[model samples]
Target: MVFGTHRALDSLTLEVPPGITGLVGANGAGKTTFMSIVLGLRTPTNGSVSVLGLDPLRQGAELRANVGYGPERNVFPDDMPASDFVKHLAEVRGMPRSEARSRASDALWLVGLGEERFRALGTMSTGQRQRVKLAQAIAADPSLVLLDEPTDGLDPVQRDEMLALIRQISSEYQIDVMLSSHLLEEVERICDNVVALDAGQLVAQGPLRELVGDVEGVTVELTEIDDVPGSVESVVARLTAAGLRVTREPDANRMDVLGASADLIADAVRDAVADSSARVRRIEQRRRRLEDLFEVGAS
Candidate 1:
């Protein structure tokens, strides 16, 4: 997708499969632009777009019927009550009036807004408003749901609650979710697969585990033994001699081991500690982080 000379979304061919998939990128990374294209709200300047086996451009109505969208920004009417707002959207999605009303109430309850269902949207807090957006999106039970930064303005507790609700949407109803977020941690916590974009270009795409394989590093914390002089240095020497690269931090009483798989590192650490008569306080294998995807893309 392009606007004037700037390519909002560059030439990209990607497929989003079932389950909860995260759409991740930094600000202005074309996350919203991609969502717009998928929803048929913006036509791609060059290539075609499809959602749920239907062309978003040609079969827009049908595609929308099977899709739900929760925009990043709040675009609700101030005077509209929460229940009315959600019900109206379900009706727009072709649900019967009675069904839409029932679904809307149920959705509000699911989002923890049942008590406030009669309250006007203008009177709700930011967190409450965010739930309202979620309620409206899933009220019609669409096959696919597109959420743009669902936790944007939420506090830490509210963020966790919202994430749990998102996970529930997929696990309970078997709905597919493509949630866009600048928060990589949020994506890492709930998404099974991820698609990352950088300046509108596809940077990374794969299952979360495949993308962030086990990091080749292990951390070992040594128990202090005042009687054992140079215990830390002795352990380091033993580990290095055992063919493992070790970096020691005497003050912190920790060593970072590299140059081998985590399992090998652990074995080497155990052997080294036993030989040096050093007690171990803790040991853990490090895991690759999701943020590494963007770092690689930037490079």
Candidate 2:
């Protein structure tokens, strides 16, 4: 996507599979431009765009009918109650008036605003208003929902609640979601898959687990934690001599195994400890993280 010769999205290509996928990047990373293209609000300069197997540019009306959108900014009318606000959007999405009213009420309830459905938008808190935006998007039973920065300005507690709701929407409700955010930890915590963009270009895109990959590290602890005085340092020195790198964790009794298999690393630790007849307590594989994605993409 380009605007007046400024490229907004360049050579960006990826498929969004079913389930909750996160679109993540820094500010000015062209996330909004990509969403607009998917919504048929803008055309790409050099590439085709498709959503749910339909050309978004040609089948925009049909595409939008089946795809819900919750924008990052708040745009609700101050005087309108939540129920009326959502019902109107549902009707505009081609739902029957009666069904729209009922669906709107259900959506509000789903977003945890059952008691506040009749309250004016002006009286609601920012968190409450955020839920309303989400409620309206899913009111028409869209096949997929595009959520742009859904947790923006939310307090920590509200953010957790909202993330749980998003997880529920995808898992229980079976509605596919694309949550766009810049926060890596939040995406790591919630999304099953992710699409990362940087400077108008694709950085990385894949299932979160695949990107994080299998455990490439481990943590080994000694049974002598209560007596780890000399044994721990001896094990570390031996592992260093045996070509296995280890780092002492903040907790003095444990050390992280780096650049080696869990079994081999554990063996090295045990052998080192055996020199002084020390016993092993436990060894755990460390899970992968989002930082791995950046490393792989940079490489």
Candidate 3:
């Protein structure tokens, strides 16, 4: 997508299916702009996008009818009550008044706002307001839903609750979801597929597990360190000399020995203890995290 003269998305391409797909990136990384183009809210400057086999720019209304969107920012009318606003949106989408009211109530209940359905939107907490936004998105029973930072501005508890709700929507409702988030942990928890972007360019896109394959390594934490940097450097130098890729973490106390066999890591640990007076608190193999893939992809 282009915003004036600058390209926000460059030759982006991806395929989404029936499961949850995560769009992850840093802020201003074109995540939102990509979603906008797919939803037909913004047009791409160069490449084409087809959602559910329909060109969004050519069939905007038809595509949107089957695709729901929860925007990143608050766009609700605070003056209206929560139920009223949702019911109005449903009706605008061609639902009958009675059916719209019923669907709105059901949607609110689905999003865990059953007790607060009558509350004014202005008085609702940020988390509650977020739920209302989600409710509206799913009220129309679209097959595909786009959630943009659904848990943004929420407390840890609220964020967990919202994540659980999203999981239920994907599993119980049997709906395909395209969730956009800057938080890797959140996406790791809820998404089956991931598409990562950086600086308006595509980085990686695949099943979350496949994208982060089995690349196990070892992490060594030491205590009684005199000079943290010096100890780490000495250990890394020795490991490298022994033909191992030793990465000293930004915080120098911990070092990750990569692509080394378990026995080699054990030998290196033994050498580190023998050479220095540093107390070895822990040394064990660590499974790679989704954050690791993100870091590697970003670099």
lDDT, residue 5, candidate 1: 90
In candidate 3, what are the lDDT values of residues 1-299, reduced to their tens digit? 66778778877777766789999999988988888888898877777788988999999888888887889997677778899988887777667899999999999999889889999999999999999989988888888889999999999999999999889989999889999999989998989999888878888888888876455678877665655446656666677877777777575667777767877787877796667656677888766666776677667
lDDT (Cα) of model 3? 0.84
**Steric clash pairs (candidate 1):** none
Q: Which of candidates 1 and 2 is the stronger one according to lDDT?
A: 1
C-alpha lDDT score of every prediction, in listed order: 0.90, 0.87, 0.84
Checking candidate 3 for backbone clashes, the offending pairs are: none
Q: What is the TM-score (0 to 1) of candidate 1?
A: 0.84
TM-score per candidate: 0.84, 0.82, 0.89
Better of 1 and 3 by TM-score: 3
Model 1 stretches with alpha carbons more than 4 Å out: 219-242, 245-257, 261-283
Model 1 score (lDDT): 0.90
Error of 2 at 201 (Å): 2.1
User: Which wins on lDDT, candidate 1 or candidate 3?
Assistant: 1
Q: Report the error of model 2 at residue 274, Å.
A: 12
Tens-digit lDDT string for candidate 1 (1-299): 88999988887998877999999999999999898889888988887877899998899998898788899987679999999999999999989999999999999999999999999999999999999999999999899999999998999999999999999999998999999999999999999999999999999998988888577799889975888877778888888888888876446678789998888889888888888888999999866678878878888
Best by lDDT: 1
Candidate 2 lDDT for residue 80: 97
| Cα distance off (Å), candidate 1, residue 86 | 0.8
